[model samples]
Target chain A: MLTEERHQLIRDQLAADGKVLAGELASRFGVSEDTVRRDLRELAKAGQLRRVYGGAVASAPFAAATLSQRSRHAVEEKTRLARAAVGLLSAGQSLFIDGGTTNEAIARAIPRDMELTIATNSLGVASALVDRPLVELIMLGGRYVPNLGTCVGADTLAAVAQFGADLFFLGSCGLDVARGVTAFDSAEAEVKRAMVKNSAGIAIAVTNDKLATAAPYRVAGADAIRHLVVERTAPAATLADFQSQGAQVHFA
Target chain B: MLTEERHQLIRDQLAADGKVLAGELASRFGVSEDTVRRDLRELAKAGQLRRVYGGAVASAPFAAATLSQRSRHAVEEKTRLARAAVGLLSAGQSLFIDGGTTNEAIARAIPRDMELTIATNSLGVASALVDRPLVELIMLGGRYVPNLGTCVGADTLAAVAQFGADLFFLGSCGLDVARGVTAFDSAEAEVKRAMVKNSAGIAIAVTNDKLATAAPYRVAGADAIRHLVVERTAPAATLADFQSQGAQVHFA
Candidate 1:
């Protein structure tokens, strides 16, 4: 069979059986195990599947965001916002962080020697903080969302609600002046709302472009947010308008 | 058409399209949207597929251990080991925790007010520590292993070796007088061994039933372990045997 044919067949098998063993695929395709592995590698690079030891599994349902894709959307804005957000942290304070590429950056930007308690839903954030000796990491438990590399659901929300964090670092799919913070998933939005409500202060991390966008699910309104942290060059007048309305704007 | 036939058709559509939209499936299967949603829910419950907001997607290949299934095994024994393990801890002490079911129990058992630095490979451990006011949690990064909910790779091993932790909390798939500490995955074993080599002291947490079993991969020998922390009712003679082999055996 042709290589593309083999790849297609492998994907079909993965969908049908939920996993594919290298030896089994090799024998079935009449190819060397090395060839099967190569095929799996190529498919993985294409974001079609995930290769595991001696086998391959179906990729997570939501497409895994590439590093470049994550870095591009509002890069400088996220960095400035991260700096401003980290400034709120004090020694011995507790925090709850939601999952977002921007939040991962915030985890990295946190000082290594500050005595702080951090509760988060992002695996990326948890992994980033693994070596910071002064930060206490608390990962909330719930159903694992493979695509996002985090946990979510009613259980996760309930767990977050039980702890009153001094500050909450939040991310959103879109933020409308009137509709509030919105996300693509309703369940995740509920979790975000729960986090916002449970924290003493709320910091919305966003780029200038995301300030007026709208998604399917509403988490909260702009008025509910305590801080609007944005990049230095973000529309100052637009930010001022938000500050005038209610939010305390921080231009980092 | 029969319910089984309808189910099979929906499964086939999901396999072909990667997702089955509720409206599309409803029309194709000559069923109502509610009926399709119900079918998707049932499939999700069976672990045959995942139900999303508007449709269903294929489930990931690996079977995740249920929370209750994990909670039951080694409950009492792990609690005993946790108490003994915490005794080794002090304010400002840094530690490395290996990934396993029992180590997760140890993470949960940590005192809420103890000030310490904790590095771990287990997601369960990190999540359990999220809310504690005094614990600093670091999660080591590597290739994420879904079944284990931890990262393991050469990078993870190298990162672990860079730190000299005050204590290392270790777990094993099996432990034997002849083989010492064993793990199911070779990659996990490599990381565990690296952790043991980088720590000031090593404590092995195991239940009595795993006393003499050997697994596919070896982590270390009994001589390298500083403390063998086990439950109170574990055979005293077995503890003596380990102590005779140069391990500091402690029963809690």
Candidate 2:
């Protein structure tokens, strides 16, 4: 088959299945895995799809939406993920939580009776916890980005360095096996990197829309995440990929 | 009149007139200003009235309410003061805003088109400014106090030191001529004092209830405040006292 024909077939398969495996594609087309990988590389370069560990997945359609716009999207799915993420917590654990609408949902879902020490750079996250008496909240200060509803820049980075928490709820823009964790903003990516480095373990609660996706800035490898909360409707093969990376997967 | 009768009359005057000038009281009672000062001191110690520059005024009774509760009280009065406070701003100026429902109202009242740099320790304040594109917000990081709805402790004090802004909108628990600016929380008081020291000028917006009241920790003297925004219903004597101390008084 011509290389363009193979690329077209891969795109159709990815569109239909949300992801495509290199080995399966290679065997099905009677071609080499290297050839399939090359096709994925070209597709990803063209922004057609995202490359994963052994395949590529469709990019999220609304990744460029503002924070408020994103908060209103997938409310039920994010809430399910939030409830599952809250289940992973104990009564008195200190947490390093990054800023995102999903994380804001998690903040709201935290039980009022639970005693927690949560440190965050997100105003939305902190505001959700303001009325919870048992929670000791720490806000990281910096230049506030209205679009993200979070504080970023040097002051935030310095503030985040003070605490090494037991768990970190990462704000993910995209998650892929091959490319690891990713984000849309460079400064936000830096903050997430610092958070991953400072925390004892990292937990990420994402909707299925973020699975097998890739963004511009890389945060860390998928192997670095210790816990992941996603929808039960996520692709089984994608769940297996994360499981292979040694992450404890929870289905919401 | 006997000493006890004179004291009762002074208390009555403070109640009826909202304040009692020591010199005026002495002249009315055919006594020296020293005698009137002694009477004022005794009343202040008893918490019956607050001592100001030249007299005593009625103490604000609802000083111990929680932040959320306070936000709900005097909605119209606060909005009026907030509007007046916003009028003080010019485009491109930087402001250090302290935490309070009044300051939050000021945050909300800031024009969307105005270009400004605002640094705050209040989650409510930052949340209010999150949607404004022209404002660059800086949050002071520290331990969050739900009761006050702001960050406090050592880290917040340290974060506040990094900037010297054009003006500061002080969060006042009590504003007095003699006792000066005061707050109910010691840590919050420290944060406010740091904000005052780091800014070029200090402004405060208060409802009629806060005038001449005194809380536990001293923030600064009324003389330190360069701008004062208050309800038009505030006593003329109190307004004159602040103006006499060099504060540019604006009545809402």
Candidate 3:
């Protein structure tokens, strides 16, 4: 059989069984375990599967990657942006923090001594602030979308409407000068839009990669961003565009 | 200074400042870094402090140790009891799962294919069920207590009242035939009491060590427990007492 045949069969097996053991594959295909391992490694590198101890499991669906997977990308950049974004907040202000790894980082970077009232639809954000004594946390109730680690649906939107926050830390999937802020999922975008509408001010911290990009659902207009935080590596022209819209741009 | 005196000073410093650096302590006390390390190790062994890389932090307050700290105790026993308790559950039933390490274990052990509606106030339990496709999760919102990994206050109690569940997985701090199921914190106990009231059946899964013991706040009476899951090593008399209260007992 061709090498492609083996790889194709492996992918099919993983899709059907959720995982595939290298030894079992080797025995079934009359190939060496080393060949199976090589195939698994290649598949993992291509993002087709996740290799484990002696096998591989199917990769998370790309459209809604798990929170843990999303957290693993651009970690240091996210932390830098998060720290810069959290610094923009004043003490004693009530805020709505959205879901995303960057937002989760901002939740952690919040000063221990600062007092705040934080309402969130993000499980990770709530978990991060639970230890701090000065922060009063209110979690919004709804259907939990595990991959995004945020609540959604009509219940979540209704809960988000009840609170008019001083600020909203928007979780950005894609941001564009012309297209405004957007999210990958429609339900998430709707919830974000509610947050944008309910808060007096809005802030978003994004890595350079997200700039000038647009996801499917538009969350708000560029002018809606009161405070925009980006890494120093972001294009100067892009920064100027945001600044022209009256956003106070800060670089991490 | 004598070793005991150094240990005392270390405790004082930790209490005053919340943390103590080994190098700073050694220099201040005219001792070697190794001596400070030894002191920190001893204190950590005694549960008086938590040792970090270069220093020691004050131990969590005993009255409200963090949930992470509590989860470290009796891990294997809890897993066993959790598995046994989860076995008593059926598909298509709605459950109210409370907060505690054992209850968190039960949440993790829930069958992925079973369709269930779960309402919980536990950060840990919600986190565990988020990835499961068949579980419809509802997070009860309130003031998040970091130590307990649970929400409390009036909001939590009010939220609990809205749900009528087929089963309540009680997070047991202590259980006794005379005192019934109890919790270390009064607020947590109140939430547990509310869960007990809203559910048709109550289940308590406990390690043998928790049997016949009592905490400060009473959650419910012995007869309230519809299902009791205990380790096989529990005292026969105690098991009989639970059985006599019309509770169906299962052993892990």
Candidate 4:
């Protein structure tokens, strides 16, 4: 196979299986493992996949905004959105919190006496909830992807699927009425999808600028999210766009 | 079975069942409950197993073993032991680090350039590793018990069993030849036991006072551990006892 053709097949295998073993690919193409490994390395450098011990995982979301990156993007807007998101919770609720700056802020703003059970895949979120004795914390196990944070690999996805929660506090890289809810990382997207699948309701806390943007991996449609939380700075038209998609939009 | 072997089997029973009755253990060993109680007492003194009414609940060396507590106990000694423990590690190794003051110190003392895969149950240890860019951190998931400061329950135990590491750094409340490797909490004991089961080798970092004292939970026997790391202040005879039990003692 041509090198480019082989690369395409490798990417296709990754997209389908979420992973590609170099040894298995080598036999299929009748090529040396070294050649296959080199292909994986190139793909990794090009932001196409992540190389693991014996294989490669699909690349993380290419969106430049990391959790810490998003933290400094829009300060007041995120805080307002976070406080608004916290208001949605009752005295007792079990929530699956995704990893993101807005979500970390929301975790920090959690009321002390809420008597809540929070299950999070984010190491930062878990750290934030440490001193809050009243809250029961469940840390989800998974492969830790540096910078992007903890990912819901197979173990995490299975754990999330087997459990049910009262609500899901969804965080997103992009949320457009037309494109729906999207994330940068595929494993993260898969985890969010599972959280939505297992929870009774889904509430997304989004910044104003992220409203009309789109990321590579789609988690769900904007309409599938029961509640859309946005800062008051969000334009009226953008809020209308989300509300028209059947979401109950809340402006902080 | 030898007396030490009997102690080990009883400890295993404690691990698998989460508790062991003195009467039942007595009958199982063809001894009276009084003899069983003596065995339990010895194990309890070594912090191998906690003594409770009737039989024993898991040992929860509750009084002085919190991560913060240990940090204050032996500053210089723990630091020296931690540095030596890091020296035992090669650049590309993976490790399962249990939760303890000394263990957290060791995690912090980890060289920044040693590319490692660290799986840990301690929130403090995970937090220490956060800014480290090269290390791949895997936070073990489970129900977070507040005071213990780590995840421990069925989930953590199951997760430990499913994973393997290059090395296991077993932390304990006490380490003595007579009592073996011991911890304060039963689940911690069980998790440490699993770490030993999953890793290629086991190395323990202990302080001077922890040398002769024993906690309630027994994690392993002296022969089972390949390396015993200690502070220079540890007494010569105590070090000899561990050496006699088949551990290579390193005084940092």
Winning candidate number (lDDT): 2
For residue A217, what is the lDDT in candidate 4? Answer: 97
Q: Considering every candidate listed, which one attains the maximal TM-score? A: 3
lDDT of 4 by residue, B1-252 (tens): 477876888889888864688778888888778988888889888877666556764454221123212222365567778989888889888899887767877887899988999998877677667667888888788888776778887778877877899888888788778888888888778888888889988888987777777889888887787788887777899888878777888878
* lDDT tens digits by residue: candidate 1, A1-252: 899999999999978965688898899989999999999999989978766556766664322231222322355456567878888778999888888767876876788778888878676576566556576666564544545556677546656766789888888788877777899887788788888888888888787768778999988877878888787677776777678669988777
Task: Report the Cα interface RMSD of each model, rounded to 1 decimal.
Answer: 15.6, 21.5, 12.4, 19.3
**In each prediction, how many residue pairs overlap at the backbone (N, C-alpha, C within less than 3 A)?**
8, 0, 0, 13
Model 3 per-residue lDDT tens digits across residues B1-252: 445446657765553344689999999999999989977886564334678888987544321332234444466677678789989988999999998767877887788799999999887788667667788888887767777878887767877888889999998888999999989999999998999989999998988779999999999999999999988888999999989999999999
Note the residue pairs that clash in candidate 1. Answer: A130-B138, A130-B139, A136-B136, A136-B137, A137-B137, A138-B130, A139-B127, A180-A221
What TM-score does model 3 achieve against the real structure? 0.74
Off by over 4 Å in 4: A1-73, B1-73
Where does model 1 sit among the CAPRI classes?
incorrect
> Per-residue lDDT for B121-227 in model 1, tens only?
68657655654546655656444565566668754665576567988998778888879888899889898989988888888888777887899999988777788
For all candidates, state DockQ relative to the true structure: 0.03, 0.23, 0.20, 0.16
In model 2, where do residues sit more than 4 Å from their true spots? A1-73, B1-73
lDDT of 3 by residue, A1-252 (tens): 788999999999988976788899999989899999999999989989876656777776311232223323366677788889988988989999998878877887899999999999888777677667899888886778766778887767877777889999999999999999988999999999999999999999998889999999999999999999999889999989999998999988
Q: Whose DockQ is higher: candidate 2's or candidate 3's?
A: 2
**Ten-residue segment with the worst summed lDDT in candidate 2 chain B?**
B59-68
Q: What does the lDDT read for residue A82 in candidate 1?
A: 81
Label model 4 with its docking quality class.
incorrect
Report the lDDT tens digits of candidate 4 across residue range A1-252: 445446657865654344678899999999999999987876553334568888886543211233224444465567678889988899778989988867876887787678999998887677667657788888887777766666568777866876678889888899888899898988888988998899988899988678789999998887888888887778889888778877788888
